[model samples]
Target: MKNYLSSSQMTLRMFAADLLVLSSILSAAWCLSVLNVSVPKTLNSTSGSCLLIPCLFNISKEKQNILDSSPEVTWRRGSLWSLYDTDGFTIAHRQKEPVMEVVGDLRKKNCTSVMRNLTSLHSDRYYFRIQAENSGVTGTTAVHINVSESVAEPNVTVPVLREGEEVNLTCTVPAPCPSHPPNVTWAPALGGDVTQRTHLNADGTQSVSAILNFVPSVHHHELKVNCVSIHPLHREDRPLLSHKVVILNVEYPPKETWISLTGLVWLGDNVTLTCQSKANPPAVHRWFMKRAGVEEELSISHVLSFTAAHENTGEYICEAQNLCGAMNSTNLQITVLGISFTAFLSILAALSLIFALLAIAIVMIYRRYKEPIRSETNQDQNIYANMSASAVKSEQLQSKPCEDKNTCTINPVYAFKHDLPDENIYANC
Candidate 1:
């Protein structure tokens, strides 16, 4: 019976201990759920920088009345889980302090504070406390801080971009110190309107944002954009710079479609015509030949090469197409002559030589015919003059009645007889 009683007692004691532990855990959880202060669980800061702890608190009606009359807020640095523990060291009070200050109004339950000159040594858990003239002091939640020596890179967000569409680009940077928040700017200034804003994050770190508004164009495609964040806390020494880059991929249709020709296009000559265009996803080229009043599709490629012929003389057009859209080039007139330029020049030269030879022959024939006629004309003129003189001499002889009619002396080569009034004589000379 004694052994059984002892065993029963031990079991009961063990159950009571378990119940006690469970009750204590429940109580602690309830207290945490009803904590008077609200603050971020974690905060980030940089060495030699400042940070703001955004906080708020609530109290019982009686304590609230007292705090509204004469409230005093305080901040301590340490890790104390119990409500009655006083092991934490005071770092800031409602009064002005060198390293920390309670910037919030205690009467309004705002316990926000600012701490400056933070270093790795300042990395720890911090707690907020509130007290009034009559109201006892009350402690609230704690926040863990992490300090680093390097600045973080800025963040850039871009959206789907298209030509001729308005867009907004957002750049955000951590703002550890509100007094001198970081400055955010964009590179290659897009000539867009920029608006700035400050935000408090749930992690107790503030951020500054810059939004750029502009209309995108084909020129901005594949362009690199930069977001630069400048920290003023490091300005006294060497300024700290953090930047992020993004390349824009803008969607556009086919543009600036045109054609280029290579090699002579005269008859029987090999020639090539090339079509070109600018567009996203590239473009497919198609060629068409327009003659008299009809249009004929010629080739379906970027280049069209063929031997020049009379049938090739016409206005050529090239069409560039992509998934976005299509565009047509201006008319490219192609005239295929009957002969090549060199052959035409050679033929012209041969014709000129033949005409020159013909002219020379004509001139020579004219000179030959003219010289003979001139000689014959000169001979006839001499004979006429001789005849007139002979007539005159014969008349004179006749007038003298041939003085000695029968005794007339006449050379064998020239002998003429003149008839007188009573005598007539005829002789050969």
Candidate 2:
């Protein structure tokens, strides 16, 4: 009876051991069912370059213990295949060198891998697998890789730019391989400084970005900005290059204010002055005149027009303003030409005075010449009278001695009214 009890006890113990083993097996199978891998659904890579495929996995506690002891991580091409099967080809393994390598730590459940020297032929769906002892798990989700000969264009991000304001411009490109990151450069090199960074995406791919920081100005407005990326593949061949362009719209204050004249201005002439400036959002113009060291506002519009006068002859200035700021133009001098009415009248009066003085001098000269001619005529008449008197006196003296008594009576017509000495009268005869 004791022997029979021992046999029954052995059978019961064996059944109990079998039940525990079955329960453990069931637990492990459930754990394997829950195992999941995280990776990007699609990835792009340039031919002859390198690609980095980031990966992670999660496992149950029971599976973790199993994988912790001895873990083997691998990557394969084709849909959901394992090392035991001939359905797929292995591209990366934890051990041994292949076309790709599992760079992540298998102990930490990271399944990241790097594929180097890729070509168009390497474009395919890839899978991740983890094995521990006799138990293994294969992820259902696969990563599809698309390889192309030309690199993709980089992404450029720009914000609203304002004059004198600091800003940052971002240029981003896919960085498939960290070790062989693409070289990024800026065309026209518009920034004060540039900074580069590498970051991982939620997906398996990584990205590299170049940030340019600068202060914008009106000069930069409407200018095109270019972001260029060069991906190095093989030293024997030319590298792949991609570029993107964006036009800048910079907001700024008024600048380079100036005044332009249609033609030379003269007194009482119709003239126009046009004010101009460079600015975003346009600009408002104001005209001013600096006369006698005082500035006076003229017009509040883009153009200032009026009849030019003496008051308008001074330094002219134009002011351009916007929301940002204001600027003044260099002094533009305006001169009124031609003589004034008052000055012309003054000159005419002076000329008339000169003519009057010349006429007075001519009249005085004519009066002086007439006086000399009259004096000569009077002297000649006096001399003729004296000669006639002398001839008459001689005749009288000659006849006086012979017929003194008879002549004195008869010749009353030729009477001498003055008393003359008898001796002087005789001597003259």
Best by lDDT: 2
| Clash tally for model 1 | 2
Look at candidate 1 and tell me the lDDT of residue 176. 75
Clashing residue pairs for model 2: none
Native-to-model Cα distance after best TM-score fit, residue 231 in candidate 2, in Å:
1.8
Residues forming the 10-long window of minimal summed lDDT in candidate 2: 87-96
Model 2 Cα displacement at 405 (Å)?
78
What's the CA RMSD of model 2 in angstroms? 19.2
TM-score of 1: 0.55
Model 2 stretches with alpha carbons more than 4 Å out: 1-33, 69-71, 76-98, 159-168, 187-191, 201-204, 213-225, 246-251, 263-273, 286-318, 330-429
**Where is model 1 poorest over a 10-residue stretch in terms of lDDT?**
89-98
Mind giving the per-residue lDDT tens digits that candidate 1 earns over 1-429? 999999999999999999987886666555444437788888887777788888888766644565655656656566444443443333332122327788887767777898887777777877776545754444557888788787888888899887888999999998878987888988876878888899978755689998989998898999998988878773366556789998988878899999998655788888888899998878889999999989999989989988888988999999999877899999999988888878988999999999999999999999999998999999999999999999888666656634656455453256545445333334321
Please report how far candidate 1 places residue 275 from its true position, in Å.
Answer: 3.2
Flag regions of model 1 displaced more than 4 Å.
Answer: 1-27, 36-42, 58-80, 83-100, 123-144, 159-169, 190-206, 211-221, 234-236, 250-253, 260-274, 281-287, 296-314, 321-326, 332-429
Error of 1 at 182 (Å): 1.4
